[model samples]
Target chain A: MQWLNLLNANFRKEYIEMKRYLPNTLALLLTFYIIFLAAFFGIMFVGDPASFEANVQYSIVSVAFWSLTLMTMNFIGFSVVTEAMRGTLEQLYMSPMGVWKIMLTRIVGQFSLQLVMMVILLFAAMLTSGQWLSLNPMTTIPILTLTMISIVGVSFMIAGLAIIVKQIQAFLQIFQFVLMALVFIPLSVAPFLAFAPFVKGVDMVRMVMMENLTLSAIPLADFGFLLINSMIYFILGLFVFHRCEKLAMKKGLLGQY
Target chain B: MEKIIEVRGINKQYVKRKTKEVITAVNDVSFDVHRGEVLGLLGPNGAGKTSTIKMICGLLQADAGSIHINGLDIKKKRLKALKHISAVLEGNRNLYWRLTVRENLEYFAGNRGLSRKDVKEQVEKLLKQFRLKEKENELVNGLSRGMQQKLAIAVALLANTEVILLDEPTLGLDVEISYELREILKMIVKEEKRTIIISSHDMPVVQELCDRTIIINKGTVVVDEKVENLLKLFETRAYSIKLGGTLSVAQEQQLLVKFPLCTYEGSSHETVVNINLEKSEDIYDLFDIFKAEGTVVESIDRTTIDFEQVFMEIVKGEKAYAMA
Candidate 1:
């Protein structure tokens, strides 16, 4: 029940802030839309005509995943930096539910909101390019949910660093491209990247959307691998975050910017 | 009185980034705050007041020693221990400026795991209590600094914690608002009976609101005594004497040698000397200097000392005040 309250409070805060900062939020969506347009035009003008349909479908899914992963993974880090700058980081630390729980609830809240934005962008991209890939919510959601756990874990790691450093904007600016590579690069091209956070889930979701596969149609081992990969990153991310929190406290960096 | 917060010999040190020189921010400091007591943690800048407050809030870790809140060790059971305490740290914008006054209150309460339904009545009470009802829907950024501060404090109160640490609650307010905040705090102290630890340089706030004060200097506890007792201690030793005539050079030299901290001010007809004596007999020594000049003593009055004067004498003297 307490967790529910925490979740509700954070979700409401995220929603209110998004509504209040409507212009900035819309600009962010437009930025993603432009990125998608760039991908669409690049494929149309530069790619082979033989695989034009397949290529456009692939770019649309990749662009949507890229925006989703980039926002989800970087949200907590940016949140921490903003809180520290706004001088509320220490106030958040006063929560008896623990800062990690607050951060987790906030990530969940942000993920939900960003998911809405991602859908809008996905549709916009499809509408502009006149290509629609199968958005198998049933198969894609469960996989995407599993993928998000790993993303949440990695978000904690970034938030931990932000707690100590307090100036990670430059780092985050460069991280969007890293997320883009991770989202667009196929598992077949780099099989070893499966061990990385969210790669397996993204690959699975992409395959499900592009190939129109059901949950049961995918091999059970693939699900098991994705689940284990997420759990490990989730746990590791939490461990790193806790360590960083301790370091921040020890160094008296939690309130510094 | 039951002890609600116990801090034992906590130490905090920071190294300068440029020079890598280790500076002790708090060294071997210890104090206990009793239930329903108001404590003024007073100190000059660089005197470790902030480091001490942060340690108690569990926002900063100590290099040595331990702190327990309601019998839970902060180091080992931090989140559990935090259940008993909340703080509005100095120089920190403790509220969301983008959020409305009501939203900030409800959100902070919610952050502490309390449902909006649970805090609705209390939120209404605090808004009215802080006289912020008219501006409840306004964003915090639009409110005056005093209102923002009041909202920050109201947010802390909504947590329903047994202990609240307010660092410089009246730091930047105008005189009217500062007085208003002091009055609100006094009412809270009288009515709520919650343990409060306020660290501030605002002497009037400390003098009026605090039951006792602990003065820290150079990273160590210099004086720990009750507010009235401190005022009385300094009050008894302070004296203002009016002399009938000017003193000779020899008598002036004797006065300076005997009481270095004493001040002498004079016009053509009269000389006035304000001095704080270390012992009762020191007054006799003062009179002898007057006698040497054959100066008639017109009047002698024991000066009433406020908390600000007492604080200055203590901090400027840099000596541990022995409380009897």
Candidate 2:
């Protein structure tokens, strides 16, 4: 009950925090419209018989999907580190909650708020692309699930790096500059042929997207390397967070700027 | 008196690996805070007051020391001890900045395990008490510093811990806000009868709220006494002297040797001296030395004392362990 209570409080805080960005909601909507136009009209004007909206197997959807997911992940992770720098971290640390409870609460809170964005994007894309609604639910479900888990891993990594990095402003700037550019890599690779371009990273995303990823697409080497990587990365993030929490407390910056 | 919190020989040593020099932040500090009393943990900047408070709250782990809170060992029973304490830390940075005052209150109250119904009622009560009823719906980030501070204290109160450790609660707050906070704290003390340990440099707050004070300097306590007692102790030291004439060189030397700290009130045509008596009979020595100078003492008047002067005197005069 107490843990649930904590989760509720965190959820409330997160909701209220995000609500102040209500003005930006219009901007987010406009961006979604632009992406839809780019997918439908841009490709049409280019005279490609490929109707991106009509095709369930379209690469454009995957690009837009991953971009939105990674953006949400980045927002949540950066917010935590920013709060740490601004000194709200100490108040959370001293509350009547366990360390794990505190971290889980924040993560869940961020996840819940970010779900709204995910929902909005999903509906906008699905509503515009109405013909491709009910194709391959079984295959799509696993890929979607794995992507969320991997996004969580990426979120954890960003949070961990935020804690370890010196000069928070500089770190965040550098991180955004690199990661925003990196989001297009998945975009660029999704449109390419499997064996033609033969890039290293896309093969990995495709490998995990397969039904028999661990057994067929790849050997059982590294004990299910993708699964292992996600798990290991999340654990290491938790470890770094715990250490940074203690360090800030000792330095008396738990409530300091 | 019942001991609500006992800190025994707490030691903290911070080692900077690059320089390899160990800076002792807290050294063998031990004290007891009685139930239902305000114990001011007074110290100058860098005097380890913050370190000691954080350790008691279980936000920090002391390198070596045992802290028992309400008879539960802090290190061994960390959660239990921490549950007994809540701190309104410095700068009012505790509350979630984007949450409204009401939301922040409800959030913390819920986190502390108050039921949903109680949280609603209690939050309303707190908003009224803190005078933030109108601003309850406003985001904390948009509020003024005073309002945010009041909200932070309101949040701390939501936890309803037995002991409230306030680390510089009045720091950076305007006079009126500080007064309001102090007033609210006083009410909480009386109504809840909660034991409070306030670490502050605000002497007036110390005088108004704290019954006793433990003054620390350079990671060690210099004085631990009742606030009233400290004021009274230094109240006797303030004196104004009436003189007959100026002093000879030998007489001035004798007077300095006897009093060690005398001010020549040249405009008033008197020599005022304040001395901590080594012995009660030291007055006879004072009389004889000044008498030899033919600087006739017309009258000696004791000045009324205040807490500020007492603080200065106590901090200025370090004890020499005379018995040793």
Candidate 3:
């Protein structure tokens, strides 16, 4: 019951904070869309007329998918640094709830908000590029859920590093590009890539969207591997996060920026 | 008074980031905090006051030692031990800057498991009590420094814990707000009977709010005594003397050796010596030094002392002991 209360408070706080800074967030998103996605689309569609429509579909869908993965990971990790810089890390630490619980609450709050934004972007690409992206929820939901579990591990690792390292913007920037590569590179060309963090989930979702396959149609081996990957990563992430938290407290650096 | 907190042989060391040099922040520091008693933690810069406070509240673990809160071992039963304590740490950095005053109060209250209706009532009461009723809806960042500080304290109170740790609660505020906060704290202590441990450089606050004080220097406890006893101890031994003329260097050196905490300011026409002796009987030794040079004593008067002077004398005593 108390944990529920903490979760509700964190959710409200996150929502209020987002509303207060919506204009700045919108401006940054607009700039990112123009510079990053627009440039990629232009480069991909310029070469061949025969492949123009295919390029439009691939580039637009990939960009939207990449944006979701990149932002999800970045927000989870950078939220820790932001709180420490704002001097609220110690305040949160002072609560009766453990540090892990507090972080989980914030991550859930942020991810829920980001999910809505990602859906909006997906539809926007569909309307602008005239690409009829798969809108099926039944097949897509299970794959996305598994992928998020793995992404959460990355987020936890970064958040832990943020506490010990103090500044992580440079690290997050490099991580974003790595995440893009992991999400965008085709799995068929390198089937071994499915062993990587979010690669299997992305491959499965792309298959379902482009090929009209249902959850029942996917192979059991593929589904089992994705589940195992997420579990391993999630547990490892928790281990690292707890280790970093102990170090931060021992160093008397938790409240310091 | 029943003991609510016991800290024993606490030791903490930090390694420098660049050179990897080990520095001790708290060394075998120990004290007891009694229920409903106000304890002052006074120290100079980097004297480990903050480290000791952190260890008590379970924010930072001691490298070696034991801390028991309400008879529960902090290391073994951390959450249970911490349930009895609430802290407003590092000035006003403890509050959410983007949240409204009422929101901050309600959130913290909710974290402690108050029902929704109870949270609303509690927040309203605190808003009125802290004089933030008019600004309850305003964001914390938009409020003045004084208002932010009051909100921080109000948030801490919402936990309804038995022991409160206030670390420099009034730092960086104007004189008016500082006085107002002190009055507010005095009222809280009077009405609530909660045990409070205050770490501050504001000697007046220590004198007015604390029943006993533990003064630390260089990561070690230098003095521990009741506030009234400390004042009386200094008041009885401090003296101001006007000299007929300046003393010989040899005579001054003799006085310095006997009373190292003394201050001597001299001119051609007159000289003044202010000294605090460890014992009242040390006055005879002081007179003997002046008598050796055959210097005439114009006047001798016992000086009164405030808590600040007592703190200065206690710290000076530590330095003098080190020199010896």
Best by TM-score: 1
Candidate 3, after superposition: displacement of residue A52 in Å?
4.8
Kindly list the per-residue Cα lDDT of model 1 for residues A1-257, writing each as its tens digit: 99999999999999999999999989989998998899889989999999998889888998888889998899999999999999999999999999899989999999999999999998999999998878989999999999999999899899988988888889998988888888888899999999988999988888888899999999999989989999998999999999999999999999899
Q: Give TM-scores for every candidate, taking all chains together and pairing residue i with residue i.
A: 0.95, 0.79, 0.88
- Which DockQ value does candidate 1 get? 0.86
Best by lDDT: 1
lDDT of 1 by residue, B1-324 (tens): 999999999999999999999999999998899999999999999899999999999999999999999999999999999999999988739999999999999899888999999999999999999999999999999999999999999998999999999999999899999999999999999999999999999999999999999999999998889999999888888899999978778988888898988988998899899998989999898888888768999999999978888898899984348854
Q: In model 3, which runs have C-alpha deviations exceeding 4 angstroms? A: A35-44, A47-55, B110-118, B239-302, B318-324
Residue-wise lDDT of candidate 2 within B1-324, one digit each (tens)? 899999999998877769989898899999999988889998778889988998898777788889999999987777777788888877667877767778778877766655557677778888898899999888888998888888888888778788888889889988988898889888887787888899888888899989999988789887888988877666655566667766667977877776776656543355555555545577688778877756778788777767766666666664232110
Candidate 3 lDDT over A4-103, as tens digits, reads: 7877877887888889999976775565456445745675656487776666666655766687778777765688788788887877777767767767
lDDT of 3 by residue, B24-84 (tens): 9999988899999999999998999999998887878899999999999987777788789
Q: Please write out the lDDT profile of model 2 over residues A80-165, one tens digit for every residue.
A: 66666667666666666754465567666766565566556655665665633332334444344444554555565565455445
Off by over 4 Å in 1: B243-273, B281-297, B318-320
Interface RMSD of each: 0.4, 2.1, 1.6
TM-score of 3: 0.88
> What lDDT score is found at residue B167 in candidate 2?
87
Q: Please report how far candidate 2 places residue B86 from its true position, in Å.
A: 1.3
Model with the higher TM-score, candidate 1 or 2: 1
Query: Is model 3 an incorrect, acceptable, medium or high docking prediction?
Result: acceptable
List candidate 2 stretches off by more than 4 Å: A25-57, A126-131, A135-150, A166-236, A247-257, B13-22, B71-77, B113-115, B243-254, B266-276, B287-299, B317-324
